[model samples]
Target: MNLYPINAGNFKLDGGAMFGVVPKSLWSRTNPADSNNMIDIAARCLLVEDGNRLILIDTGMGDKQSDKFFGYYYLWGDDTIDKSLARHGFTKDDITDVFMTHLHFDHCGGSIQWNKNKTILEPAFKNARFWSNKDHWKWATQPNRREKASFLKENILPMEESGQLKFIGLPEIDLLENSELGFDVFYANGHTDKQMIPMIRFKGKTICFMADLLPTAGHLPIPFVMGYDTRPLLTLDEKEKFLNMAADNNYYLFLEHDAHNEIITVQHTEKGVRLKEIYTCNEIFN
Candidate 1:
């Protein structure tokens, strides 16, 4: 099995919102903000080449939204999904599965694209089965007021409409169970419902994908939860548990939003599970 980090691109998000109550004095040191107070974030995706199956985890925001709509989040960078795939000798057609961690636009938008005529939407990965949980699917489709803006219909509906949606239910081991991976599913209600973090096993080490739970290495502290999370206290509990486990087991955390740090290892210190080391994924995989 081979895993590749797919760089969809980069975008800007408010640093305050990204790091809840954490004072600017702290987070700004690591993720320096622009004059507008927005920090750069990576729309990083993961590609897994497992035998005959080519699975992609999280598609970055696609280029289908109107300029007005996209004006809100300033997308930048030269690296695109196409170029990133080409870097690894693959293409959209080669993806057999799209495992979405959640349905926020930045996570799943790249799964579909505008058709040739630019009149309608079509599956971006023409031949892949898009995977999302049934419960989260319903929640995202019929989004609540707080999260409605983030769950855009253009980024979601096309998957089910295209007849390529698959559900990874609760109990299936080989299909979607937490035990198959080195880490267990520590579902948190804070950052949208049922946000699944894949506790991955790698070469005698365990690494986890910190989707929005810990967006960046700067967010390692327990209370630095994002304001976007529905239930902040629930997020605190989830982080406390997960980070403790990660420190105890020496898990390497893969950050989705951090522009600088690719992977971080944490150690149990007097201050808590503070970051032990920051290294690029290549340093580990190679």
Candidate 2:
């Protein structure tokens, strides 16, 4: 199997929101904020090419939203799914599956796009089957007030409307081994309900797509949960368990939201799990 790190786009998010109650003095050291108190964030999606199936993990925020809506996020960079795919000699139409970690706008927004003339919303990847679990599908479609803003209808419904939406059955336990997408899926609930973190084995290494469960290397500490998480206490527990397992097993964490650090391996230190080494996508994936 071959893997590619797809750069969808980059944007800025408030450091306070990204790091939760963690003091700026602490988080700013690793994820230094700009003058506006915003930190750089990348919509670093992952592409898996196994046999005939080309699966895209997330699509980043699409370009369909209005300028006013996007201005709030301080969008930056020239990266787009199209350009990134072309870099690998592929295109959106070449994708067979779009396995969303969760339905948060930044993770799944690029799955749908505006039609020509802006008449109606449509599936951005015409040939791809959009993937999400039943639990998350329900949670995103019927979002609570706390997360309503992040679950946009324009970014989701079109997949089902296009008759290309598929659901991955939730595992009875925390992890599902060898899923339909040909990888183990570790279910995480603290970030959002039923967030599926893909554990892919390639080139004799385990590469885990660390969605919001561990957004950046700075979040390696168990208590450094994102403010956006609905259940911060649960996130602490999940991170502690996952980080320990990653450290013990020497898993290569593929960070999706970390603009600076692409991949990292953690080790158990006196201060608990801490970043052991940072690697650019080229260093690991290539």
Best by TM-score: 2
Candidate 2 regions exceeding 4 Å error are none
Off by over 4 Å in 1: 171-185
| Global local distance difference test of model 2 | 0.94
| Best-matching candidate per lDDT | 2
> In candidate 2, how many clashes are counted?
0
- Evaluate model 2: give its TM-score: 0.99
lDDT scores of the candidates, listed in order: 0.84, 0.94
How far in Å is the alpha carbon of 171 misplaced in model 1? 4.8
Candidate 2 residue pairs in clash (backbone atoms < 3 Å)? none
Put down candidate 2 lDDT per residue, 88-184, tens digits, no spaces.
9999999999999999999999999988989999999999999998999999999999999999998988899899999988888998785589999
